[model samples]
Target chain A: MMKSRSRWVYMLLMLLIGAFHILPFYLLFTTSFKPIDDLSSKWVLPETWNPDNFKNAWEQANMGSAFINNLVITAISLVFVVILGALAGYPLARVQTRLNKWVYNLFVSAMVVPPLTILVPLYKLVADLGGMNTYWAVILLHVTFQLPLSIFLFTGFIQTIPRELEEAAMVDGASRLGLFFRIIFPLLKPITATVMILTGIGVWNDYQFSVFFLQSSESQTLTVALSTFFSQYVSNVGWVAAGSLLSALPPIVLFLFLQKYFIRGLASGAVKG
Target chain B: MEVGGVLNREKQTERLAGMVGRNKRLHPSAWLNLLYVPALVLFAVFILYPFFKGIQVSFTNWDGYSQTFSWIGLDNYRRMINDPNIGTVIENTLIYGVCSTVFQNIIGLAYALLLNQSVKGRGIVRTIVYLPVIVSPLIMGYIWYFFFQLQGGALNDVVQLFGNQPVNFLDDPKWNVWIITFVNTYQYVGIAMVIYMAGLQSISKEYYEAAELDGASGRQRFWHITLPLLMPAITVNIVLNLIGGLKLFDVIMALTKGGPGYASQSISTMMFKVYFASQDAGYAAALGNLMFVLISVFSLVALTYLRRREVA
Candidate 1:
């Protein structure tokens, strides 16, 4: 009897906690569809559901352009980060050279240092290179910051792959590059997915780097654009809520679809440290 | 016949190597070096070079523009030390960091322990809990700001149900920092919970079974077996939260803007304002350097202490 009662208590507590987590999203979603007059009240559901807010938000806030810019930057940066990380990580994992070991250590230690410290100087450097307001500037910065962690993940993963496979391939008359492309890279699919999602979400949602590097309205990423939109339309709660939901959709959808890999990636990345 | 063929192939490869010369023998590692160039060049230009440049810029009176600026020899640091707002900024930062870290861990661990049980809808519940973690903190801040706004806000409406007067959660100086900290905790507790759940799932069931066999109560089991075994997760969560809290910018920017008379100003937000708004680039660099040192020290100390407690 006591056990059953305690189980009920646990269920109730979990439900409440779940509610707390879901409330903001619910509020955002429901309130986005709310008419302007219905926004100021505590009522969650709209008196009349209105889907026009999304259209209004997209056009007025320039979220369409912002969304496309974010997509382009994130996709490009993810490709580079994953490719470069795997390329660097494979050698560091397999090779026994002192240089490889030193580079691996450099990547690991770099993870602990916060990036904001270098913000000012990095901006200046990009400006000097005439990279200001360019997608390449943001993309390169994203690749740089994402590389350390991606390389870390890749190296750890590649180390687990047996050395015997490479030897067998080599004995079969495969060149060094051929062996990697045929044998090693295919085995990296899981870690590559993890790296893609982990870094993809980060670059997609990044505010600080985008704010500094991509200052022009044409180049602004979703988060930066949404923030500017919010300040401008602060009085229009329904419209702003719609914009927030729109900004949040890609990541939330990605997380839902790749839930298993996302959790596994975070767990592996965190505990190994 | 196959063995002889393999031996002949090895000899043939030796001949090929001889033809290719010693340069060809060094080809693999050299190829690896070529693979490493892109990442190396990017890091040098964007991360490492800027870090050193930031250090250099902190000593000069560079207005973030102009080709000619003289080194002021620690003038920025001197001004930073004497700035009256520095004291409040430090206090607010520590409070924000310490409170958010503690609450996130506590609530996160509590949720993890609860969800570790066999329950209906566990997967869905877990998904819901972790939803906020993927959303941008800047957006999360804006969403929560509605709840804390003075008039027609969610929290104020809740207070009205109990016949209490509405409180200005964000406008009040004393309450603003705490509100911002709570918002941060709300967004991040999901990450902490997910990490702790991983840690909890990793704990062997044998420990619990043995404790039960020994007639250990649930409380005792949790205290002895669970807490010690969870040290690794605890360490990771704490270090992440501390570093994140120390360098928090976006949420504060979206929510309070470190406002109501700089009462809730953190180091990063203060640095941004000083650099851009006040046009004090040198002093801002100094502030950034100071923050870097503080974060490094805090991370080192926390990692060392917590990692020591993690069981082998």
Candidate 2:
């Protein structure tokens, strides 16, 4: 009897927690469907569900351009972050030298310094190179910010692999590069996948560097684009709601699809390193 | 004695050299060392050089654009001490950091305990909770900005269903800070929960079994067994959340722009406003340096204590 009562309380608690977790999105969705007239008016349900809000938001925000730009930057950043992180991780994991140790420390310290601190100097650098308004500026910053953490993650995972495999490869006359591509690279698939997902999500969601560096309207990513909606249509409740929802959709979808890997990667990336 | 010992060492050295020569023809340890050069160069260019440049720029009175500048030593640091916004922004950041850290841990640990129940759909529930973490905080802020809108927001709509007036969550100064903290707490609770869950799972069930055999209640077992063991995860989560809160920018930028009179601005947001918006790059860099020093000092003190406790 007591145990059953305890179980009931537990269920109630879980239900409450779940509701809180999902409530903001629920609110977002409902507000997105409301008409401008109904948006500020108190109503449990929209008198008429307005699909036009989405249409207006997409066109006014130029989401098509923003989406393509975001996709390109995120995809390219992920490829570079994963490849570079793995390569950096491999040597740091294998080699024992004062220089390697110093390099490792340098990477670790980079993680602690907040990216915003360097935003001004980086901005100046990009502006000097004439890359300020280009996609490469945001892409490069994302890569730079992500590289250290991803390298740390990859290094931790790499350390768990037996050194015997690489030593054996060396005995078999494989070049260091050949041994890495043949053995270490193939073996690093799991960690690489984790790096890709984590870094991909990070790059996909970045706002600061993107907002600062990519000043051109043509190059505006989804984050900057969604923000621009607010600045342009400051008082348009319907358009803001609709634009907000559209901005959130891709990530929500990505999370749902990669739920298993993302959850694992998040925990491993944080706790392991 | 010295001559005999030196001769013996020379013989050993010759033998070692011959062995090394034999392996050197095959093993490219020296060449493998070169693999790190490209990555190191990239790091120096992108990470190291930029950081030093930031430090150098901090000491100067350069606007981001002009070629001419004078070095203003300690003026930026002095201005930060007298800045009116400094106290309020720091206060807001601390409140946000502490509240979010405490609340996230308490709720997260609870979920971890509850999920450990042999319940169905546990995995699905965990995944659902983690969903928001994958989204950008800027986008999350945009969505919630609408949610907290005084009218036509779902929050207000729901409140009206209960016959209460709509609340101005973002515009009101007091509530605005809490609301900002709330959104941060809301988005990150899942991550904290998942991390705690991992920590919880690592604990052996035998302790619980032993406690049950001793006629302990579920609450007692948890306080004794679960809470103590989860400290490492707690320490890690707390540090991460606190630092994250201190450096928080995007959400603050998108949601309130540190408005309602900068009531909800954090250290990071203030830094941005000063540097980019106000064009006080030197003062902003001073602020950034302050945060860097604070974080380094706190981490050294707190993290060391945590590590020692873990070891004990």
Candidate 3:
């Protein structure tokens, strides 16, 4: 309900916000594409797009092995996070017993426990358990930290499925386990997508936990590898930018394609807080 | 329709809750609750156990390695209090937590409001704003590094256009913390915008129309109708941002490495350096406890305060 003149100001503001948000990425793109010797300002695209930085980054960053580690950790962590979160959510959502309610509160409260607060002991524990630099160790850590949000979301979504769906099946002597597997789990698809995206992104992008726990060269994730690489070669801005760009590509691509789900997942997950 | 949908969801929840009460005894196989055992086991081992262990370690003189370290009684915490950098570290953390929350909410709400209107290309703008949230904060730091790298930074590029001296935005202690907060806000403000947009959308149009009928101006409607109803979203953003910001590590580590002589260290990064660089595990654990206490107290207070003001 604005006049045309005011609408112009409104649109201008929108443009500015858009430009401001994209500026870093734009600068990143130009930097990543430029060669080490190219001394042009970050604003200017190289006269000739050079593949050398990307090639050098791929080699020096140890990206191939790091990619594999990240994939394995993220993939296993996602599976466990989803299954365990969904299972934990079921009775917590449906039963609502005193113990279940307490358990649910435990999961929710765990959300506030910043993982780093326990970093000292967590690292020690994992090290004592001989879990450092192993896939399962980091995987379990990710699953543990991620379960709270997943449980919260799963519980909320399941509660909305009317009780009759289960009760009616139970009257026909459908076993409780049978009921969940046959009737309920399928309906959890939407929330599973949300959980996967939320937790998946988290595990994939995690640096705080991964940097310490996944320390070895063989076990390093993208962030860990890139951090080590970047620090060692801080003078090589083009290489660092390229490595960063390479590391960022998959999530950015996934987000672009699954834009709706990504935004909805973030809003629903956080607003329920 | 919005009211009805919310009411229906609430009623369904209420009815499901009622069923839980009614069927408490009807259902014999309560073993279904055992489904959560696997998850609880992970939590117990990874989270619960380590939490207590962190507290225990805080009281020790462990050097983060070696077989034996003596018990120290509150010595580590006393050291934390006496540590010259502790005050600056804590101050940096609060600035990170509070400043980011404030600016993110303000800017995020503004973006949400603008995009909520009938504008062309707003969809793309919203997508662009949210894109950074998905990228790794470590990567996001490097992306900004190219722009703040002192020698050939983009900020300096723009500075030279104005015939000014090139500035190293990241290296300066005065600007680094604020710049880190800015990057953090930029990365996460999208989430805030989405939450507020959801909050704004859920406010019934009738309230606005009723206020309009009373000749209320835009500002009045926003202050009266919108702000109060949006309190829940505000509470969520504040608590979430506070916690997230307080525990910030990646972006700072990537950008400054808590550098220029611990000048830009938050508690999280500071604790990291203490443990790894200084090999003071006991002090690190104490710092961790302090951070835990800091975050929990801040978020709980904000939650309680905001919850009281919530209209619903």
For DockQ, the strongest prediction is 3
Quote model 2's TM-score for chain B: 0.85
For the candidates in turn, chain A alone yields TM-scores of 0.96, 0.95, 0.98
Please give the CA lDDT of all the candidate structures.
Answer: 0.85, 0.77, 0.89
- Give one digit per residue, the lDDT tens place, for model 1 in B165-244: 99988888878998889988998898899899999999999999999999999899998999999999999999999988
lDDT of 1 by residue, A16-90 (tens): 988888888877877789777774564457778899889999998888889999999999999999999998888
Q: Candidate 1: which stretches are off by over 4 Å?
A: B1-31
Candidate DockQ scores, in order: 0.56, 0.42, 0.59
Q: Judging by lDDT against the true structure, name the best candidate.
A: 3
Better of 1 and 2 by TM-score: 1
Candidate 3, residue B268: how far the Cα is off, in Å: 0.4
True contacts kept of each: 0.62, 0.50, 0.82
The C-alpha stretches of model 3 lying farther than 4 A from their native spots are B1-29
lDDT of 2 by residue, B139-207 (tens): 788777777778556567678779998888888887888888888888888889999988888889899
